[model samples]
Target chain A: MRAQFVLSEIWIGLRRNLTMTIAVIVTVAISLALFGSGLLINRQVDQMRGFWEGRIQVTIYLCNEVSANPQCQENGPPTEEQRAQIQTDLEAMPQVESVTYESAEEAWQHFSERFESNPALVDAADPEDLPESFRVALHNPQDFNQVASAFEGAPGVDNVYDERQILNRFFDLLSGLQNAAFIVALVQIVAAALLIGNTIRLSAYSRRRETGIMRLVGASNFYIQLPFLLEGAIAGLIGGIVGSIFIVAAKFLLLDGMQDYFQFATTLPISELIYVILLSIVLGVLLCSLASFISLRRYLRV
Target chain B: MVGSDTRHHNLREHAPVINFDNVTKRYPTQKRPALEDVSIQVEKGEFLFLVGPSGSGKSTFLRLVLKEERPNDGRIHVAGKDLARLSNWKVPHLRRRIGCVFQDFRLLPNKDVFENVAFALEVIGKPRRFIRKVVPEVVELVGLEGKADRMPDELSGGEQQRVAIARAFVNRPMILLADEPTGNIDPATSIGIMKVLDRINRTGTTVVMATHDAAIVDSMRKRVVELEEGKVVRDQSRGVYGQAY
Candidate 1:
């Protein structure tokens, strides 16, 4: 029966301050959505790193007659002895997990297959024109720097390249995006907290008379505050539901929409989406309750 | 002091509902204490009038009894519990045993007469079945049985006061405190309010009232404690409002 009274009080408070209540709901929804997006992006970056780190290799391109690299001028099409020596040194390095020697013919065939759709580029290339190289895979992909420095300026090597370096730049962009989203979400959360505080203060002020009577009638502090706390929690719950909807819409329209185009990068799974939604809802409810509690402490004596 | 203690002991045997022993209350912003070393005792089932001028500390006396404010220099015991010894958490329990009515009739404007009265029981977590049974009885006691559905704004000033009284008494408190409850209504309506209070007191509930209603005070002929400039100037059993002037 008392719960019924408190529920009715909460309803009356919300109805009386409908505009402010809506403002709180919308603010919390937008902030939680941004927060959820930030978490999702972090998850995506981790997944992409897991997918790419294993396959990334450091390529040591040996000098060839067609190579314009300065190292090739002194070597003159790289003697077989020089190539064998370079291959032996790469294999002996502790940073090198394993090295595969790709001859010019094999390099040409791999290149042709990669550009199979672009016949014009494949026709311009000759088997003898491709540089022979060693493809070195490190046990730890981050050891690319150690392997690259070891092979650079070697006798037969024309250029040292780590494929992971390119991928690192891509990941750096993603990390930057994640940080920006988190900052925006943080700002929005602060704004939402302030708005919730103001809304609660206004509600309390407008109902001061009722509270005064409640005090006179022997209402406990908890009894007086329960309705207001529930008011904030209800608004937060609605905001969480809306935010979850936004996250689901974003997953469908943005991530799942591009699933076929970016097959190499794995899409976030359903479990991740569910986790984000639940987290956003919990965060919303806690944020609102905390804000309301603070305002009540500062503004309402009871 | 020894004689007063013996007197208090005798009153305690009679179940003194309120005992104020040299209670003094001073507001920091004021130059003088609101209540100054005033001692009064009210026995159970007594109807007492606290008559005083605008700043004679009548309201302060009621507030101290309610535990709304502490006495700076004395002790008060209500229903056998020492006000100073009462913990903060136990204040609501103290208040639940007492009912208060104000000059403004402090009814929730949005709630109807029945809801306003039922609110008292609801806030204290009374069962729905009990509330359904008691609300109407109290409403009928205040002679507003048919008007229970009317909102505060729709009622006359006297009816509003009746609703306030019903809300206060619905909990069946051991004591009722009225601070100028009839101040806003006409003389005719003030009598009506006093009769309701008198009826509630007849049920063995102690009644303490602070008021400026000279006519009602003279007509009721109850015990009167009058204060002047924060000091008790008169204590008379079956007193008139003033010097019969």
Candidate 2:
């Protein structure tokens, strides 16, 4: 029954200071939602990496008679025995998942189809300009370095290269973006915390006499603090709901509808979006709780 | 001193709700002690008053009774317990036994007279049914029956003081300490507040009122302790307000 009185008083106090309570909720919601967005982007980047790395292939170009690159020292094409021997060596390696040898003509056709978007590059380059390559898919992408090292001085091998460097540059861009998001989230969270603290302090000050009278009337410390704490909590909850609605709207109207032009699918899904909303509520509670507690401690003698 | 060693023996079973013994209290920023070597005693059902001009330390004496401040030297007691040694943990419990009324009324602006009186019981965790019965009774005792739902600002100054007195006595506290219960009210309202307090005193509750109201003190002729510059100049039974008026 005593607990009920305390809870009821807290309810009344929050209702009395509805505006400041709403402010705290908005502060927590907006900051947490941004934090959640950064998290989602990081997760998407991880998914994309896992998807592409599984299909990545290691390529080894064979030396040709007309080639002048230092590693391709041979003046004539390799015999069928040499080709068979190379294929056997690659198949025997534990790291090599599969092997497919493409002749020079096949390599040229692949190049033409890949560069078909740029007619000038495809029309200007001859088929002979490209190399006859042996493509090897590895069970472990990390093990590509070991296989490339093994084929370093093999006969008919011009160069052994892994696609990891190209993938690294692409991943570097996404990683940088994720870092930028984290920095933005950090700065905004601090600002929100300070705002919450100040707002609650003002509210507590406005009702200073009330707090003192509560103490005189045998109100426990927790009882006196409950209303202010709830005030901030309600604010955080409201802010979270508002910010989450904005986030969902942004995902629908901006990220999803116009993503085809930019080809960036970093937008969070509806389920994940719901996860962000839940995150906002939790964030709102924690931030407002902290802010209100700190504010009450500083301002109210209780 | 009212000679009653037999009553003193009974006080051991039920503590004399307040005690002070050569208690001297000086504020941190003041040159003189706010209360100096003050010693007074009262039986469990006694009605008492502290009367003095402003700055005569009557307010300070009342504050000490409440343990809002501790004596810089000597001892102070309330409800048979040492107030000086009470930890922060015990302060609230000590407060629960005492009902205090301020000169300003200090009523909550948001609450109506019903809630105002009920608030005292509510803080002490009275059940809803008990509150529903006790609140109206106390409100009627203060003579504000029709004005139960009226806000503090809506009431006149005397009516607000009545509401405050109702709040103070609502819990049936062991002691009721009123600091200028009729300070802002007219003489008629002052008589009303005194009458209500007299009824509370009749109910075996100890009442200590601190005020400079000459007419009320002389008319009631209760025991009055008059102070001047932190010292008790006179202690009289059935005393008038005296020269300070």
Candidate 3:
């Protein structure tokens, strides 16, 4: 019965401040959506790093007729002995997980397959134009510099290339985007907190007379505050629901919708999306309650 | 009905319901104290009028009893518990035993007469069965029987005050403090409110009313404590308002 009374009071309070309540809901929804998006982006970045970094290899290109390096020109394309020696040295290194030899013809085949979507670029390259190289997989991709330096001045070597260096640049761009999204999310969250506080204050101010009477009638502090706290929680709960819907819609439109176009990119698993939705709801409710509780402490003396 | 309840029989017959000993209260922004060196005792089952001119500490006196403000210099005891020593959390329990009616009638504008009175019980977590039973009884006692469903804006000044009174009395408080309960109503309606208070008092409840209503104070012939500039200048049984001056 008392719960019924408290619930009714919460309804009355929400109804009385309908406009302010909507403002709080919308602010909380937008902020939580941004926060959820940031979290999802962080997860996506980690997944991409895991998938790409595992495949990263340091490539050692042998000197070919078309190679511009002085060392490659002097050696005139690595002799069979030079190629065998380079492969042996790479396999002997402790950091080298494994080495795969890609001959000039194999390199041309891989390049052609990669550029299949751009047939014009594929037809521009001659089969003999590609260089024979040893693709060196490292036990730890972070040890790329050690592998690169080990083969840098080796005979018949045109140049040492760590795929991770280029991948790092791409990941850096993604990380920067994630950071920017997080910063925006943080600002929105702060705005949501302030908005919740202001709304609660206005509601409390408008009901001062009723609260004064409540105080006189001997209502406990908890009893007086329960309705207001519930009001904030309800608003936050609605916001969270809306935010979850937005995140799901975003996933459908941006991630799932691009499935065919970016088949190589990993999509966030359904479980992760569900987790984000649940977390966003919990965060929304907690943030709003905390904001209102602080505001009530400051403004509502009862 | 005085002394009819056997539960209250164990309480000392002459024990004061409210006691103030050399109590002094001052606001932070003001140099002069709102109440200065005031001492008074109100016995249970008595009707006392707190009469004073404007800014004479009448409201402060009632506020002190409510523990809304603490005295700076002295002690105050309500229903035998020292207000100074009471923990802040226990203030609600103290207030539960005392009812208060204000000059403005402080009714919830959105609530009907029934809800306004029932709100007091609802806030205290009274059982629904009890609320259902007690709300109508109190509403009938306040003579707003047919008007229970009327909203505050729909009621006259007198009816609103009666709703406020019913809310105060619903819990059967031992003491009822009226801070100019009849302040906003007309003289005829003020008399009606006074009669309702007198009825409650006769039922063994102590009544302390703060008012500047001379005619009601003169006609009621109750014990009157009059203050002037924070000092209690008169305490008379069957006293008339402005008589001390």
lDDT, model 3, position A261: 57
| Candidate 3 residue runs with Cα over 4 Å from true position | A116-119, A257-262, B1-15, B153-155, B243-245
Task: For model 2, name the residue pairs that clash.
Answer: A21-A235, A24-A235, A24-A236, A25-A235, A25-A236, A25-A239, A26-A239
Q: What is the TM-score of chain A alone in each candidate?
A: 0.93, 0.84, 0.93
Please give, for residues B72-153, the per-residue lDDT of candidate 2 as tens digits: 8889888888987888767777877788888899999889999888887776667889999988998998788899999999
Q: Residue A57 error for model 2, in Å?
A: 3.1
* Tens-digit lDDT track of model 1 for A42-105: 8888988998888888898988887788878877777878888888888898877899999988
Residue A296 of model 1 has an lDDT of 91
The regions of model 1 sitting more than 4 angstroms off are A65-78, A93-95, A120-129, A257-263, B1-16, B71-73, B243-245
Per-residue CA lDDT of model 3 for A117-175, tens digit only, reads 99999888898889998998988998988888888879989999988877778668667
Quality of candidate 2 docking, DockQ: 0.46
Candidate 2: list runs displaced more than 4 Å: A1-26, A63-69, A73-94, A115-119, A147-160, A250-271, B1-11, B21-26, B36-42, B64-67, B70-76, B81-90, B123-125, B226-245
* lDDT (10s digit) by residue, model 2, range A169-198: 877876776687678767877877888788
| lDDT of model 2 at position A8 | 70
| lDDT (tens digit, per residue) of candidate 3 on B1-245 | 56567547756666699999999999999888999999999999999999999999999999999999989998999998999899988899999999999998888888899999999988888998899999999999988999999999998999999999999999999999999898899999988999899999998999999999999999999999999989999999999997665
Q: For every candidate, what share of the true interface contacts is present? A: 0.68, 0.47, 0.68
Stronger candidate by DockQ (2 vs 3): 3
In CAPRI terms, where does candidate 1 land?
A: medium
The RMSD of every model to the true structure, in order and in angstroms, is 3.8, 4.7, 3.4
Q: Name the best candidate (by TM-score).
A: 3
lDDT of 2 at A25: 58
User: Is candidate 1 or 3 superior in TM-score?
Assistant: 3
